[model samples]
Target: MSSSSLEYKLIKENNSTQGISIEGWKIVTKKLPILNSQEIEKVQKEILVPLPEMFFGNNSLSVSNDDYGVLFEFSPIDALKLVDSTKEGGEKVKVAYSEEWTLKSSKNHEHIKDVIKPYDWTYSTLYSGTLKIASKGQKFEKTTERIDIEKLKIPEPILFYDEIMLFEDELADNGTAVLSAKVRVMESGFFILQRFFLRVDDVLFKMNETRVYHEFGTKSLLKEYSSREEHYFKIKAQIPVYKGDDISQLTNPDWVSSKLTNSEELILENLNLLGGNYSKI
Candidate 1:
């Protein structure tokens, strides 16, 4: 028997006063094919139970918390269903699977623990890997680290990107995709706009449509003068590349350059640096 490869994508959605919203970005999964020899070995392993049964059971799933919030949960079955629904004709197949958990704050909440929401999420096929068998069972190793978020002191307006390229195969040569940017605000006040870029492979096609999150810092301050606040902002855009487009055209360019240039021009034209820090992240 031989194995085949598959890909999967994970998405999570939530509802807010502004209506339904989506948090986080996409994640890719690489699946190894199932082979006859592997199937037989799986049966044998089931009989012997060589693996640790404790971690293999429902206990395999759990949640944690930080100053942010409790970890939400995701289900493999739910991801499969989402993929099936979006497929061209709803092709049915046995897909490689996994579970995910995310901890998010409520719309009106400040900290994760205060207004925490737990979600059991799932993703569809993203990517698959090759399967191999070994005569002697392979050894396994694991490591764990724990840290207190409140104990660590970090700056406000923490900027983070989802790192899209790690799951390149999930993207098509001329297909469109969305990248999310999350800005977490701490200590409500004035923060200047800083430089940011998509940081995608040059080979990635140009984005067709782009949407940005409203500058909440300015808006929130106008609404209230409260301190010790946080905001999660997201921006989603559609990549613009058609099937069979030259891959070379998409490769190697400063993705954030144009955006930075535009910001500078906007500031110069307005004569007021209303936003905070123009430094690139």
Candidate 2:
């Protein structure tokens, strides 16, 4: 599983795209500027949803194992599409300032040129990476398995790493919403994390995370998706006494995630990379 034994290749493009191919596995990341007006309009039309204030429509990250013929991709378009539109009542997120923003935009009546539309301003998404399988009879199955966090903490040297931001919005200045993905490769294997964080100043804080792990020379991979949320004041109370009013810790995703007591299990599954290698783990 060491780098010396693998055919590892790194491809870098002028447009800020990078790719790593090793041992029949490929990981690619693209970081581009925010979409122009025309690109935003096109995406809005196709997605039929309000684009975020700062939308990076061209950003994306993808990982695939040629041995299994499976590709997992993360993109702004696909991630935002999963956000609940105004029509979808289930798990709809509306912050305290949602009403204030809408009312202020309508105050001018007919004279106003544009009015703010009502949707999940927080941009909460349960996106756990899109999966595509090209090989027949190979698929992901539910399992009680979990990533070996203890193993990952064993201090192995990281061979490759990259982080990419998919999209973000200020939530009308009420708070912030951001979605990002990162990956790290090690001699034992690799790990991928896609996280979405939302914070509403006085209302709530939320996080949705997807973790994928693949051991070197293995024929399968494991993925776990989980969500955690808590009211704003409750998490704020967890801040250290000396750090009061600073609120810097609240902006940290890792800190806020650890304080979120309300937890939910969204998805737990494992995929067999090679055909007929379905022995349960």
Candidate 3:
């Protein structure tokens, strides 16, 4: 629990409202109802294959069969901490966790130009590309919109697993921008909360939003997080944080928000676990 050059501040209620900002911060929320790796892989390979098609909706985007072998792999470089809260519910779940996860993609793509051109960048925390914004008709030469990652009190922080599962998502979602963007574009950091096994007093529930970059990209595309406001977004599902006790519960309050209804069924089917059903499939 000793962090080098880490500063601590008690964020009060007044500070909670009006966008919580972090300098050089990345917020990772991991939803693990079926914490089994093989089940997760099955969801990624079988269930998610059709998502990009659903996400892009008619834009021509695909990988050559040969590209598949080279394009996907897992890495341990990604770190994890319990997200104090998240956008999983119609509102933030004060009781359970929200983990931050990203879809790992190899820079090599199907975009063949006789000679392939690779953008000399690996990861993006938030979509902070200045040139891409200009293409969208912005006034400034460069202005990065600071995303709001909630402020929380992390007791102890640690890496989630020895190795994080990395894979390519067929669909690339630019937040709410997914509703548009007809052409097939691979989404970075687009994720869903399938389900969770909750304990309000869970050891992993407390976490701090690490001071990190808006995203990882080309040297030019990497912009420092500025406090100025550019564009504002008001989501329909705006849930606030709450206070809670150290208690166990049978049902996750945010079960309705889960994309996977068969989490318990998958667990029982794969692992033959039949007793506990916090949010049983």
List all candidate RMSDs to the true structure: 23.8, 4.9, 24.8
For each candidate, what TM-score against the reference?
0.19, 0.85, 0.15
Model 3 Cα lDDT, one tens digit per residue, 42-122: 444433112222221111111111211111111111111111112332123212222211111122223211111121011
Candidate 1 residues 135-211, lDDT tens each?
Answer: 12221112122122342244553322121111111121212222211222223221121111112222112221111
Score each candidate by Cα lDDT: 0.21, 0.78, 0.19
For 77-178, candidate 2 gives per-residue lDDT tens digits of: 999988877744222443333553345446644532222345565788888888765454666789898899899999877768999888888866667999
Q: Candidate 3 at 51: error in angstroms?
A: 11
Q: How accurate is candidate 2 locally (lDDT)?
A: 0.78
Models ranked on TM-score: 2, 1, 3
**Sequence-dependent TM-score of model 2:** 0.85
**Winning model by lDDT:** 2
Q: Which window of 10 residues has the lowest lDDT sum in candidate 1?
A: 223-232
What ranges in model 2 sit over 4 Å off?
Answer: 1-5, 87-91, 94-117, 276-281
Task: Point out where model 3 deviates above 4 Å.
Answer: 1-3, 8-22, 29-31, 35-163, 166-281
The lDDT ranking, best first, is: 2, 1, 3
lDDT of 2 at 182: 93
lDDT score for residue 66 of model 1 = 24
